[model samples]
Target chain A: MRFQLTEDQTALRRATRDLLERRFGERERRAAAGGGSLDRALWRTLGDAGFFALCLPERDGGVGLGFPEAVLVFEEAGRALLTGPLIATLRAAGEVPGAASGETVVAAADGWTVEWLAAADVARPDTADAVAVRSVDPLTPLHRVARAARVDPVAVLLTAAEQLGTAVRVCELAVQHARTREQFGRPIGAFQAVQHLCAGLLVRAETARAAVYAAAVTGARTDIAAARLLADEAAVDGARDCLQVHGGMGFTWESEVHLHLKRAWVRAGRGGGGAAAEEALAAALTA
Target chain B: MDLSHTPEDEEFRARLRAWLATALPVLPPPPDPADWPARRARDLGWQRALYDAGYGELHWDASPTTRLIFLEETEAAGAPYVGANFVGLLHAGPTIAAEGTDGQRRRWLPPILRGEEVWCQGFSEPGAGSDLASLRTRARRDGDHYVVDGSKIWTSHAEVADWCELLVRTDPDAPRHRGISWLAMPMDAPGVTVRPLRTLAGSAEFAEVFLDGVRIPVANRVGAENDGWRVTMVTLSFERGTAFVGEVVACRRVLRELAAAARRDGRWDDAVLRRRLGRLNAEFLALWRLTQWNVSEAAAGGGVPGVGGSVFKLRYSHARQDLYDAAADVLGPGALDLDSPWVLDRLSSLSYTIAAGTSQIQRTIVAERMLGLPRGR
Candidate 1:
């Protein structure tokens, strides 16, 4: 009945948070946004740290933990807004050479689009003839493709995991902003409108976190589908709300709040769009 | 991270499930919330059967997990759960268990468990619903008996209850919250009258109990004379616990039903309808997860359910209402027709928004209590 993370999981989260805070501070995050492709060195660092190997078997040169541990790490990665083809490489663990080691970078391509293809040493192509295309997120580039295969469920779940992270991160960002940013005379959080918004954001994040964690633990398709749906809603809507909390300052390019919204927008479309997840969920509910 | 119960829990669940499978068929279904006498008769019989088998409030020392399993399995099996004795079992019983003397416990606990007596709550009054401590229900100590004079409104099952967990303004001069006292008053005593009050859904599950100088024994006072507010809080905690597990289990089934109905009505193809259903379910799962986290947190700290009560209650109540609202939305014009099965559920579920505490009050609690926001002007 216990839902609290084990000591190992909590430590893993703390380590992941510390690493990203050290590596991708506000300065590095701004620098890494050159053409929306993550820095190769940072990508290498993630790979070398066994981030991709978390769920892969130990014999296959992976950490051999499981989805729960993987989710815990992914949540932190999400919180830090560390962007890259993390989900793709993690999915390709044990199957693709150098994926678990970060020696080779992996890019993802659906039928018409690919992410991080220009920098990728290897590509998990949903298409055979993938042509790189521009993506909405400047932090992650996209590529067009000729043909593509169905996305893996694990990859989909990982996207959800990332979305869950962003959802939680944006919630904290909003609350932090609300608590500190004064308006009219007091902290905006002291105002009912701002307080209610923060409350709503908290609700969205917690609800999505609950679903995502449960899905990560069970790996049930229905749970994952629901998780993906809620996490996307939470991340996207949460980002928008966070932006609103930040006011005109949040709308400016200098503010990191907009980056979270852009990131949420990208993650929401990845793995599979809302339509794909919705179909599975509707079937499960109707069945 | 394991959500599933232990082997021992599974065994309890299994035995309870087996018992329910056999016992439920023997007892008739509850008539309706409004039909107090008939529903109570059946609920009492069913409860006594469960109590005889060492179920119900008889298992006072059961772990939180075990209690949850019992609730989950009972809902899944559609077994009767002594709904007729809700106040007696869930609130009054728990309050007495926590605050009563040894002799008082011996006298009250067994009858509640055995279903020989039903209990009603006499807390809210005409002028004091949410601001319950401002209650004017006066109870004057008159030579070993307290003469109660004010009326209690929204008292559930007052007509059928043999006793009431009464809150009275024992000391009007004291501060509002500090002046109240908790009493176990005999409902059949002289000068006591019950008038049924039907809700918008046409169910008389509540009553306005008029207490005109009804005498209560001095020994029946729970805690001290002016400490009734604290005792009343214990009863409300039990009321809050009532929402923890059953609603999740039941709402899941309702979601499934709504989905099936949507499909049958050819509304499943509508993307908007599908998304609405999906979103409802996602929130429902969130509510379920939140409940689990709350339960586990309580278990870990050996604390009664605290924190996130308002948040959890507010979210889950709306989710329940949204479920029915969506069902009706998918059903269209038929949703308005009384003949349609969805209509009653849709119409009846609005109570969720208002019952226990209104959503606004819940928000205030969340704002002031959980979020640490200052109290409103």
Candidate 2:
């Protein structure tokens, strides 16, 4: 009946958080984004630490953990806004062989289009004639892979995990801004308007975190669809709200808040858009 | 985490379901306030039936998992609400069980369990709605009794209640939150009067209660004097109980009904409406999972609720309202008809946002308490 992460899971969370904070803080994150390519060193560091093998099998020379642990690691990755083919690479670990060792970076494909094709050592087997496309999110490199019949739901689930993390991160950012930034000699958080925005974001983030985490554990397509839907909304709208809280500073390129918004906007269209998740939910409910 | 129930819990649920196959009450709450006697009788009869069948004490010492099973099964069986004894069962009974003296528990809890004595809460006043600590309801001591004076508004079921859990200022000179006391007062006491107030939806199930020098024995006090605020807090926390499990079940029912209605009315094909319905359904799923996770967390040794009560209440209220709004979108004018089942629900949903604490206050609680946002100047 208990719903919390276990002591081991909590320890995993703290370690992941500490790693991201020390290795991928604001300056490093922006620099990596500006470089517009994968941080090979950081990626290798994570793989060496078993970040990519949390859900893999011990028999396969990887940690024998579960989806709960996998999502915990992804939650940190999302918070750090870690770039490149992490999701695709993790998914490919059990499929493409070399991916498990961080020696091969597999660019994730969503139907015909893929992300970070230029940065990957390997691409999904189905992708062909990949062509680079200008990306809206500075942190992600987009490519148009040849049209394919399928988009993996696991890919969507991973994107949903990132969205959940970003949602929580933006909520923290909003609260931090609201408490420290003042208007008319009071913290902006003292205003009901700002309070409600922060509160709403907190609810959305917490709610989506629950959904996404449960979906990971349950491995139910319907639950995953709902999680993706909610995480998308939370992250996208939460970033907008956080930007509002930061006022003019948030609009500046120097502020990391806009990066959150850009990433959310880009992620909202990835794996599967709102319409796809909506169809899955509608089918489940109507059927 | 596992969401499935233990075998024993499943068996407990199955037994209740089997009993409810025939024992569950079917009387829809009457629209007419005048029909309250029949309604009250039916509600009590249903409660007594469950009591005799071993549900009255089901929650007294039950695990969170077991209590959730009870609520889920009861909601599934369409069992009637404890009706006029809602306050007694949900708030007062638990408060008595937790804070009452042994004699008070024995004296007060059984009737409540058996549905023999209905209860109402005397907490809100015209001047003290959100700022409840500022209530002017005075309870002055006068030789072994407290002479109570002042009024309370929005006291639901006051007209039908046999007793009330009253909060009053026992010391005007003391700090606002420190001077209060909680008491169990017989509703028929001298100088006690109840005037029914019709809600905007036109249900007279709530009332305004006045006590003009109503003399209640000091023995009625539940906790020590000047500690009433803590008692009141204990009572408020009980509002976030297993009832949320039932609500999730009920919500699924209504959502299915609304979807079916949308299909029959040919509105299901409306892309905008379909998208909205889909989003709302997803939102409901998230909320349900959140609650289930909360229950599972509590069962796994999480502490009793804190600001979470406000958070869930606030979120669930909005979800319910959003559902009804989507219903209206599905049914259009059909939802506006007063005779439509959903019309009453849609009209009544607004009160949820206002009652207990307004949505505004709820947001404040979540911001200041849960998120640690700065308090307003």
Candidate 3:
């Protein structure tokens, strides 16, 4: 069995990365983050690009690709740090009337909180009495809602794919900073301490990548739970380590390192703060 | 990104499983771990069976996927491991196939594949463990032979091995890494001594060998005189990469057993305990996927593993340790009983981080080779 990406799959990933980087690259992302809301025009552009309809069947006027391909696209979105109801909108593609075409926005309730609820046309569980709350990640605004529902394994796997992407991106950032940033008459990467930190980040990221990719293929509940757990650990811990490699500069609002850590923190809390995945895995093991 | 096996792979798997169904039961009971002769015989008998079935050379001859299938099936069927034959089957045999001369391969490959001989490793010396390039096992050239003089520690199954894949310092003035040569030293040579080294688990599977003027033929050199380090790295990649495929399956089995015990003992009620077992389960499952990734990558890029092997090795070492730690939590007070299940496994888990390559060295490999980080000194 070949566990690596095929030529077409690799090309799809590269193409999706190129598309997202053009729209949500650092400059565009920062410019859009200042508003703290979803850009409808850009959202429609994503819909036109078939981002949301990636997994809808061809009979429904969509891309008809499977979860694996959608997972790849979402990974690129995560790497670009694209915010909004992306996961919710993507999950609602077949169910929500206009979601597949980007004419409608969908937001899924994550426990008692919903992200970008004010801009959403439909909420997954129809939360009422929503109140906007300050979020740690400036780009992702949250609205507290009176709805809590069990998340399906597919959503968990998709969220894990996003975390995998963040893990990989932060690992690259840490390695880059360690190489260029100097301390004690040399680059900090020359020190074993910094080097090991970056190495550990890479190890965690790669391990999570494998798990996420395998889970996408298998789609097993246990596999998805494991993937979620590993991807969360990798993304959260990797961003923290990436920040460590950047030293004082990473602490500034101007640098993108803290943004990644904040985003990772927010995402880790999305699928029940890792407790749900942990409990699911524990149940599987105990059975 | 297909993870499904090919039709041929599935067919081969089916045949191997059928063969093992009949083969494993008729075999005699396994000898004690400390029984060197008996263990050798049992292991060789299994190898001979594989040889007769045309699967003996799968390690080097077949595709990586096929080899993986063989390993998975054998482990699942409770077939014998390459216990006394690991150094030969996994390390030296593959290295020789990759770097040895045609003549050398014809001579050494047949006996090992046929289960007619066993090989032990002679790479780690007393003075050089992690810094293996500084090894001072002197092999002074004299006519057509090299007179080897030194001591090698942690030689596994040396008491039963017929050959030793040796590394020695052939040049004193060259660079530390450039002065070494690889030799195949006969274990029965004069002035060669083997003293079993007792492990913390109280097993003598490893030994220390003292060589005083043990002579080895020049024809036995696998590569150029000073190119042994590269060849040894090839052997080590095999050691770190595919050598542990069987153990992963075994670990999964042990994890299931641990989970069952947790349920039986009412420890499953503890969310913390259940969560620990669950996390270990995830860890092994991820490790298994990582193994598949590495093997698939190796299949694509020749038969040698890349830096990804180090990543897998670094994590798998700790995962095995964690699995046993959870096992102890499941066992409660019985963890200390020597005869209890997994007690020996728990004890042996301590060496996983130290053997093959230390976790420290693995981190260096990943940092420098994989991440492109600057090397420290």
Candidate 4:
């Protein structure tokens, strides 16, 4: 009956938040947005810390936890705007052989060609002892040289989880901005228009969180699509609001908020878009 | 994480189902607005049969666990739940149990539990729907009774209800939300009239209840004078809790029906339709979990989670509307024709968003109470 996070989940979240703070701080996030890809050392650090391995069964050398725990981890990741092949790495960790041990990165190689992959140092093409990367989230460092399999709905759910994290992060940034940024001798958060926007962002974040958590618990494919739809909206909209709250700063490369928006836009297209997700949900509801 | 019930509970459910199967015939789905009276009568009969089987008093203190079992069983069976005078049983009954005199409980509880009395809430007037404290209903003490004069709208089941759990201003000079008294007023009293009002769905499920110089016995008073605001809040909490669980389950059934229809029409192949169904399915699942959390929390004697009810209500209502809109969009031309039974189902879903409370009000509640945001000007 308890909705609050368990001790293990709290530890996992705190550890993840601390690691993200140390590895992908505001300066590092700004650096990544400028040109660099996700730091591989940090990726390995998360793997070692068991963030990617949390969802796997205990028999698989993983900490068998539940969706609620996963939610806390992803939410913290979102707060840090820590970008990488998070969805691919997490999914691969659970199902893909040796992927959980940080040996491979799985990606979906459909709808886009896999040519020059970024962050190829930690992962490369055509080396048997090398990384087996699938070309998914091409914008991220998830590309392994192995032949990619067809994308599954599970991948959609993972992506949705990541998006949920990103949305919440953007929401936090927006709230912080509203509280600090001033206009007309008062914080902008005091203004009705700004307050309404922040309120709306909160609503979207909560709704999306509800959807994603439900999907994770039920392990239903339809629920995954639903979560994706909500997460997609939340991320895109939350980032938009973040930019709005930051005014011109949010529009520039110096601000990491737009990076979340871009990444979310790309992820929203992955698996499927709003139209496909909505159709599936509508059918399930009516059926 | 374990949602399953004990074997004893399962046995209780079996007995309830067996009893209901014998005592009541399976009712047809709710009919058109033109056939509402017949539908209402049939529903009332079903409720009576349930009461006879002791299923209607699930929330009553007679057997709290058994009452919970009743709700669980009714929900699992996909049965049309006890619908008549829901406000009475869920809100008024609890309020009386908590604050009413011993005589009040002894006299009122029996009729309410026996299906011998029907009750509607008289809190909202024409000008006092969301801002309920502004209600002008007056209940002046006269002898051993109170002379009540005011009107209450959006009173569901009022036409058939025997009484109303009403809130009235007992002291006009006191501050708003203060000096109010809660009373149990009989509907058939000297100056009471019920006029059915048709909703957008075309059903006259609610009524405008007019009370002019209606006399309520002093014994019928719930709580102390000028303490009605707190009493009303207690009642409203029930409205937001147990009563809401049944409604959410009912909405789930509708969503399931929509899913089935989509599958039947080969709409699953359409990406647009699939996405819509998927989203609705997800939202419904979330609402379902939220309900489970609410029930389990209450059962464990924990306070209701902050604004979680508002979250549930808002999501449920919005998802319901979205489900119907998607149904109509998928049905296309077929939806425009009321002659089609599917169209009627779609029409019924429209009321889900507006009924009980509007989506906007639910959001306001969530914002003001749950989020601790200042009220909108």
- Please, what are the lDDT tens digits per residue for candidate 2 over residues A262-286? 8888788775467878867776678
Q: Which stretches of candidate 3 lie over 4 Å from their true place?
A: none
Our tally of clashes for model 2 stands at: 4
Model 4 C-alpha lDDT versus the unseen true structure? 0.69
Ten residues in a row with the worst lDDT in model 3 chain A?
Answer: A145-154
lDDT per residue (tens digit) for residues B149-171 in model 2: 99999998888789999999999
Candidate number with the higher lDDT (2 or 4): 2
**Better-scoring candidate (TM-score), 1 or 3:** 3
Candidate 1 per-residue lDDT, tens place, B1-377, comes to 66777899899888988888888787775586566688778878877887898885633447777777887888888775557688887788888898999999999998888878989999889998777778998999899999999899988888888899999998999989899999999988999999999877666768999999899999999898799988877777656654457768888888888888888877878888887887777778777777776677666767456646666777777888888888778778877787787677777788886777777666666655666654443
Candidate 3 lDDT over B1-377, as tens digits, reads 77999999999999999999988899999998878999999998899989989899987788889999999899989888998779889999999999999999999999999998999999998899999999998989899999989999999999999999999999989999999998988899998999999999998979999999998999999999989999999889888788888889999889888888888888888889888878877888898888899989988888887778889999999999999988888888999999889989999999999998899888888989998988785
Best candidate per TM-score, number? 3
What DockQ do you compute for every candidate structure?
0.48, 0.68, 0.77, 0.32
Task: Give interface RMSD, per candidate.
Answer: 2.1, 1.6, 1.0, 4.1
Query: Candidates' lDDT values, in order?
Result: 0.79, 0.83, 0.88, 0.69
**Angstrom error at residue B164, model 2:** 0.9
Residue A74 in candidate 2, Cα distance off native in Å: 0.9
- How good is the docking of model 4, as DockQ? 0.32
Give the winner by TM-score: 3 or 4.
Answer: 3
Writing each residue's lDDT as its tens digit, candidate 3 over A1-287 gives 88899887899999988888777788877876687778888899899999899988999988998878878888888888888889889889989999999999999887666888888889888677888888888898887766566676777888898999999999999999998888789988888888889889999999998899999898889889889999999999999999888988989998998888898888887856787777888778646
Please list all clashing residue pairs in model 1, or write none if there are none: A36-A138, A36-A139, A36-A140, A114-A143, A126-A148, A126-A149, A127-A147, A127-A148, A132-A143, A133-A143
